[model samples]
Target: MASQPADVDPAEFNSLNEDFYRADPAETIEHRLWMLAAFLADESTNVGGQEELSLSRDEAPYRKDRVQFAALESTLILHQAAETLLRLCLAHWTDAPCPWFEMAKLRQPRVFPKKVAHVSNTLDTDETISELLRIVSWSGDQDVIEAGVKWGYENGWERHREGLRELIRYCCVVIRDGADLYNAGKHGLAILPSEKGVSIGEGDVISVRGPSLTVIERQVQDGDLRWAKVTHWVKYKESIAITGKIASAVRSLWECGKTAGLVVAT
Candidate 1:
């Protein structure tokens, strides 16, 4: 950023920011409205050096976007105006997380807005481009944002990739990758006791026999034997069809057990 005029003091900035934060939302936004006016007062803050941008006009698209993305009240609307448009969002300028990204960390949904709540965290310099890609925000240009996030994550923002991935998932980016690993074939699979009987952890594959439905639940127990959680497991689409086959298998087990004089639960 270019240096401010010598007359423009920096010491008052903290007080200005504090007052801005404490002001009623309207007053806070009014202050930003004035800042926009000031930013556009210079011809440089516009599409061309010949024209000064008009917030009332040019800013309307971004304002609408912010309203949808953050659900900003009338008072806090200026913050979004200043951050997304007044700052680095210009096509010719460098893009970076705004300084207030830290402020968003200390504030509430009101400050950061709930829709893009993922970006409210304090973003460090080390945060990779990939990490930023995972943040969920409403850009009218979803495709552009998605590409930016993906590029951000894969490039310098490695640490933030998971977070951005989570945001992308939250936004329903489609075709998530990790749902097929745990499945039970036939009687479907159930979390049953291992031959040795230790609890299974995530990603451990265990064989379950006679499961009317393959249940990928937390390990449970029946008498001395452990069973997987019966009520809360995800049923795989393809393998779930085996439930009927397992039911027939169970009936055969019941008949054979009874013929052998073995007791069976109802």
Candidate 2:
């Protein structure tokens, strides 16, 4: 690392320190991986199911409503991560390029019941932790590595803004049990399988699909999927404002995206 010249203005050093922390979450690879892992754990959450009746009440046995079970069920795959034996279930929708986005779906440090997927480092703890340490050390370079990290924070945020919001909303579902309107609505019970696969993207509202009706953030399921949250159509109406804001952000993002040659055709 090059030391600053004594003649250099001290203000330059102070300004750099101020902006760097603001960029820390993005610039630091460790933090990015940490956030990504957090997001993965978030979206991977599924609250209620038939056999899992922790949320049901005595008087209202076999309750079909889901709102009551706000506490809901939570299953973390393992005490270990990446190396543990667990099925790597890539959240897939169709047999299309949508498969690529799997990389961005951040997950947690959890080991599933079986080992279904593996990254080069995941199989070995020594290498994985060592590589992370290397990156941390690399960040000390300031010019070469730090600049690239800062660029990632700036660019990844700009590139995946809407995509990230969709991720964030799902995150809300995991962290805030009450906010999981889909899983926490009504009795938060089961009738049909909430096979309702919701794959929200940059310019889309999360739509929960069922055989009979496809609802956005609210719907009951019928199939092998699992139990679903009931929708209070009236209360959910207010979410339109939030929905609208997401749409607008996606639109602005798309418009700007074209300049960077990455526009998604809605």
Candidate 3:
């Protein structure tokens, strides 16, 4: 039903289609990473105190709302970037044809390592995390490594797999722990700026005072009821840390892709 335009030759169009099929995977991954870097840069500029703000009492609420909006959007962008990194990692490990589309159906972080495991018998989720951490050479930074170790110690993660697991759990995985807010933002738009607190006595209370956010989800058994589940405490510092980790991982992947391409060329 479609015909080539008079000005365009059929042979040239067919050659273009062939070129598409023969496109370089490494170059494709680089382009995706470049776009992701642009998104991250934009998010950073908006949330990194670069924007002017009024300190007047009358404009306090407006300033607070603007900060909350930036936090929410930045969190979403970081999560999406993590997923993109996971997909790129899978593609690099598998070296499969049309991997972008082939792995498009996999949306869960847990499943990504499992898919990689299929390609390699010994590389499980933890090993995959370790590989990524090693590639990034995060151990060279004393401050970063110490922070990861401190977090792992506080959270009861094993010393053997502490730093590796921490990176995967915090910056990479997005199913259970760091996922509810992202899912809520994407699906129901049920995130709200709130405080996390607990009642102690009739008139007393213990509260974790901070600028935080909560995600509300519909009750599974009772669809009519909405459950205010406190998911993330929305720390901008933590978001920035996670973004840095993702950026490091992306850079490592770019280098690895280039090395792999060179190997194949020889």
Candidate 4:
């Protein structure tokens, strides 16, 4: 009798291949952006509900840390979605071979600026390249383009050079700022720092988690009698707004791209 191999589940394995790695590039980008947006929106809702809960009744200090961590995670998601969208836009609209690769290398911000700048040269002749560069500058101003070019090897025209520069700026802010915070959080800076620490007082509730503590204090003067303790809680409302903005911006960009006939043929 032939024994059935436990690890060989043909039906399950086939189902995984159906949509996991077979999505068309264009559709995949769009779908991923929407999926990230939905996740961020859910996080926003959770944070809001948590805030309301805190307001209605006394929430354990740990609740604040959990809500803030969720917000930070949402920020990280928004940043990733923004960068992916930029690369996708270039791939869809640019004439350069390997547009996505060029865009990724160009936006490195630390290394390969020179390499990225030369990417524009791959588009067309100097005249078309110049025009494309001009058009892609966040502002249509020559000085702005020149400044961008001077600041880094970024010629700003990776994709045959047609894009919504204003929208690009909006998206960049979210991605860049969120990236800094996200990196910091990932590297053991998850707890936001405060100038003053909460002092444990009689009858005051204190809940401490790993790197996260509940503290409520405005400022501590020298020689204060109360003991100062650090907290891991963070204010999440601002983060929530930023994530929502990023999601909205991506949706708007997608709509604009569709109107401009940037869909991939099935």
The numbered model that scores best in TM-score is: 3
> What is the C-alpha lDDT profile of model 1 across 128-230, one tens digit per residue?
2233332223222345445655553343343334444442233221111111112322124322322122235565566332212123533435645554434
Q: What is the lDDT of residue 162 in candidate 2?
A: 34
Task: Name the weakest run of 10 consecutive residues (lDDT summed) in model 4.
Answer: 208-217
- Steric clash count of candidate 2: 19
- Distance from true location, Cα of 229 in model 2, Å: 12
Each candidate's lDDT (Cα)? 0.30, 0.29, 0.52, 0.43
TM-score to true structure, per model: 0.17, 0.21, 0.52, 0.36
Please name the candidate that would achieve the greatest lDDT relative to the true structure: 3
Q: Report the error of model 3 at residue 94, Å.
A: 4.4
Worst lDDT 10-window in candidate 1: 172-181
The better-scoring model by lDDT among 1 and 2 is 1
lDDT of 2 by residue, 1-266 (tens): 67633433443433433332232221232333333334334432343352467654323322222211111211111111111111111212121122123223324233211112232225234443232222222211235445554554555433443343343333233233333333322334332322234549765576554222112343345645554435321222223233333333333322322232222323
